[model samples]
Target chain A: MKNQWIHIFSGTVKVKLTGKGIERFLNQLTKNGVSIWNVRKHGSEAVTFYVNLQDVKKLRIPARDSNCKIRFLERAGGPFFLSKLWTNSGFFIGACLFLGLIMLLSNMVWGIEIRGANPATEHHIRKELDKMGISVGKMQFSIDNVESVQRELTDKIGALTWIGVELKGTTYHFQVVEKSEPKKAEVIGPRHLIAKRKAAIVKIFVEKGEPVVKVNDYVLPGQLLVSGLYGNEDDMKTVAASGEILGETWYSTKVELPLKSTFQVFNGSEKRKYSLKIAGRTLPVWGFGDPDFKEYETEVNDHPIKFFKWELPLMVEKKTLREREEVTRIYSREEAVESAKELARKDIKNHLPENAIIKGEKILHQSIENDKVKLTTHFTIIEDIAVGQPISQGD
Target chain B: MAKKWGQYVRKWMTQKMDLPQDVMMDLPRITMIGQVHIYIENHRGLLAFSDGEVRLMIKHGQLLVKGKAFVIKTILPEEILLEGKIDQVIYIND
Candidate 1:
């Protein structure tokens, strides 16, 4: 039974023998060591039996000696199949070419996504990517890796502050951060320094103006902190007021913090499985067994094979199993309240000027409700609050 | 006279040593599966074969198998596999 395939693969022939003494011819064949089976007598002078295709040539001798005519009834097995394939060689070649084309297309870059860039910069980036051989329809292997791409892009585009490049399957994703243009210096004329916001003066230094208000004085918006006039009123001459005034400003912010939070974190034990997907059926090529971990996360990435612009039904799927554990953090009421105040201070600091100094923070209210801590905090920031106002002719 | 003496001595040796007659005496060994198939080992040659009967030359005689719808399942130099509905097996002394 095990050798059945071997028997068929070597080929077989059904032969019909016609002679006066067919049995003698069969016996002669057997004596010649030509293993024959399924011998059936046809009429009184004819017989039919199956023999190995290779031994057909040997039958000519006994066939001549016995004076019998041997006609091949049927030819089968591997050789016949190969000859049939040869008859349709064109179709076979076409199928092979189609498969090869599909394999080539599946490994090409189909799309390039440029994010966080304006139209002009995006066009520029696309040109650069083309120069690097990373454009659409190009083979992925010919292009550089993502890290090198990022480095090259950052180096080539002077206006870009930072750029991130990622190759996701057949698509390339680019994240670009462009450098902001610096502000030009403005020409100053005769002007007074006025408070842009209501604040209590903390410190004042006048470089080219008369100090009209002293430190610890409270001023409103549009009020003059330093006048452009110099000396007494009789000898007053107007000039640009150049000064730095540190004023104290206050901001109230509300923040909420949850006392309990639950999140999942990976423990770093990972197992990868690779499989070929043909028309929705998956055939695992590696990593046959499923992961034994009970609590885990599965990330499946499917790369669909393509032929030219059309996507083929075949795909390659990669599954990553990572062991994960759920972590629940519980914070005490005091800790929650403290974090809430800290959050509120950070919130106010973000809206303040770059050189602003946080003087103090006072919690106006604190309450715990529904497993959450809510806090209202007031922050005092000391920053430069003076803005130059041009002196009009009427003034 | 010489052949008879050799055969007698071979028969006596087979009985004394408890040896298989087919091995010691050049006799044909026939194995039958029910009435449908038969295997003949150590046969000299096939003399005649038909749908109703099969004849083979044995060491001392010709073995005949009378049956219906007889088909030779396999044929080798030293063995034959015959398939049919068998009625009788007879040996003709020459």
Candidate 2:
């Protein structure tokens, strides 16, 4: 291998020779395509000159008998080092790498997020977005008519009120606002508050109109509870189109709670896992397989695909396993009775609205029915089951 | 034979005396008095002295002077002065 030459000193090259001899060397070097850099004299006896490496190679001297000495001094090459770094090949390769990185990053959408949507509205929006070529793995070039596509999607889907598309860095973010459904106006032209499901009426209160069905009446779905009629014994005139109905409905419920139940309580020590999904395929990024917890049950619900407006994209799923301890204790006769009463009250409460008033509760019977304790409860409640609004003249 | 003897005598005298040829060559010299300090590059020796005592060595360019509380008022790159009672002085060869 040829020796790699580097200049490590900066002072002038000194030659203890006559000025005529120095000029001769310069002429010879120039004839051979050598370059001279600088020349300086320290005193009368020595003259130093700097030359390029090519010129240095072409330098020759006469016989040693002549009164002249030739010595090669090192030169510092700090600026040369900087110049070499800016070479054509190095600069070209650097530019290519940078441009390649930018191109690759622009092709992949780093962020895709949807906001202001309920689950159902978001699902429809996601489907619409996918049809508009905004889904994962779809190139940006495929989307030709962006504005018209957005307009068509919003007009067809009743949920989306406004949609916006934004590109930040390499990611495309879709922001959406769902249109709220208009509420139904009250039926003012001869209507009644009807039952929505099959239930026996337990109590009734007439707040604004006459009741059609009395208490203890078994009503089916769509059966009217309050009549929208007025006038004495003669011809019944429909004064108001609809009347408000407030009645308590009853339901029979059978819930089996084992005498010795096993319930797991988490012991605070849990393991968390993370995954990344793309196009229905999930890739685990953090934890390995599903975790195994001691004395614990695992419930895994993995949803690898997510929709934004109408576009389906990849989603990350997280699962956690926690250690648990199951403990069981025996219940005395009074404890069991109280437990049964509580369970019956919960069952009756589930049948009524959140604002229902429980007027009274009476235990009809308590017995062991086929290896399970059963308690029959008779509850008097006042609740409003009227969902339709009464329409007036102006409305 | 006499010329050879004279050359040997000249070399012995130079070695014994140790006189430097270039007095203004790169020599490190520092001077300080009170709050000001000065450094003279390529210093040779003291040509003259006034207002304070001067101690210098032409060979080693080392000089130190002690006095009764002198303050360095101002400083430049080449020259320095001291203002106090001259108590001690020393010099060494380069």
Candidate 3:
């Protein structure tokens, strides 16, 4: 196999060895490790075979020793092709020039596209980018300097939020996202932390300002938990009143669940169908007749083999649907109570904030009726009750 | 006495080691594939070449193959590959 590849690359010659001493001549050739293949005899005077072009020089010794005459019949492979290439020098030079021209053209930026920008922002960015050597007609490879230029563009143009630099086949695509006006912050001079909910204080740790209330204090919604003012007249100071105040908050939740429920069960059977959709027109390619099951769920999948960037009208869509039977189950009283408790917990969780800790829970009511149960639970949660109130300097 | 020792050693190698007889005794081992191609291993040299026959020198004899369109596909110091329409293969012991 290796010998064949060598013959193919460097070219091989089919030569006819004539005269009576051909066998001795072949023996000498093989002894010297000269590779030859595909030998065939045409009458007693001549035998034809293939030899490597490199080994043709070594054939002279054996030909003379064995009194045989060697003659070339055919030349093949890359060496032969190269020899032909040298004969047409003008065509070769022209071909190289044409290829070099194409390569030269491919490196120059042909078009510049600025997207997601207004005319004013576009003009601003284009000017900045052009000054950074990213304009049209610039060499595409010089865009390596685009990173620092990208930062410069963002800094020079305050309106740009996000900027991108891309070179796509001799075209510069500059994408930009403009910045929107920021909302103004409302700052007040003094502030106090007040109870947002009516609850008994569980814990309070003030990091700044003076504490006005302690733990276990029953406070109304508008009462202050921490005062922002400090010191005694003339040297008095006011901070933002930063503190975490956890209070015991209460909530009530109700839940109802039916004793009987229906669930789906597979019947161990399935059907498949294949179809093709072209330009909004669907042609059923396979599978026939209506579905066997009355209640079944269908899943559709369409895969279109794309060409270039366009979605050709032709596409293959496969739909697989499974049939299921509904079965009803009745729950016992104990089972119903367990499920009812679970339902009541989930319902209370929905009404509580994420940071609200449920410290205690009690079932306030439970009633059973026709195929249903209703339950109500009261929950005690330790949650932050601080609310900021902006006050005037005089207050 | 030396010839006897050589024969004894060849026998021991052939029986004990199970090596190819051609390797142990320096004898030509000819293998043929459906009379289309022939491989002669452990050969001395090629004697004659013709359109209808090939003659090769083996260790103790000359191997003569009479065939039509005879060709020496490959010839080596110790082996030769022949391809032809072979009708007969005769070992003329010398």
Top lDDT: which candidate number?
Answer: 1
Q: Give lDDT tens digits, candidate 3, residues A253-283.
A: 8878789989898776767787889988889
Over all chains combined, what TM-score does candidate 1 have? 0.55
Which portions of model 3 miss their true places by more than 4 Å? A1-190, A233-235, A263-270, B1-94
Candidate 1 C-alpha lDDT tens digits along A250-293? 87888988999999999889898989999999999998787878
Give a tens-digit lDDT track for model 2, residues A1-395.
Answer: 11123333222232333433443343344344443433333344344555544444355544133355567665435445445556666777988998666554455545556776788877887787777667765645344334655677678787677887665444565577766855688445554466776656766765555677877787787776775566786876554434334555554455444455566677777776767777777788888864566565553434323222333365556666677887665556567768877887788787777888777777777776444566777776666666443434352
Per residue, candidate 1 scores C-alpha lDDT tens digits across B31-90 of 999999899999988999889999998888899999999988888887988999999999
Q: Which candidate, 2 or 3, would have the higher lDDT against the true structure?
A: 3
Error of 3 at A395 (Å): 3.1
Better candidate by lDDT, 1 or 2 = 1
Clashing pairs in 1: none
In candidate 3, chain A reaches a TM of 0.50
Model 3, A280: alpha-carbon shift in Å? Answer: 2.9
Ranking of all predicted structures according to lDDT, beginning with the best and ending with the worst: 1, 3, 2
Q: How many Å off is the CA of A194 in candidate 2?
A: 5.7
Docking class of 3: acceptable
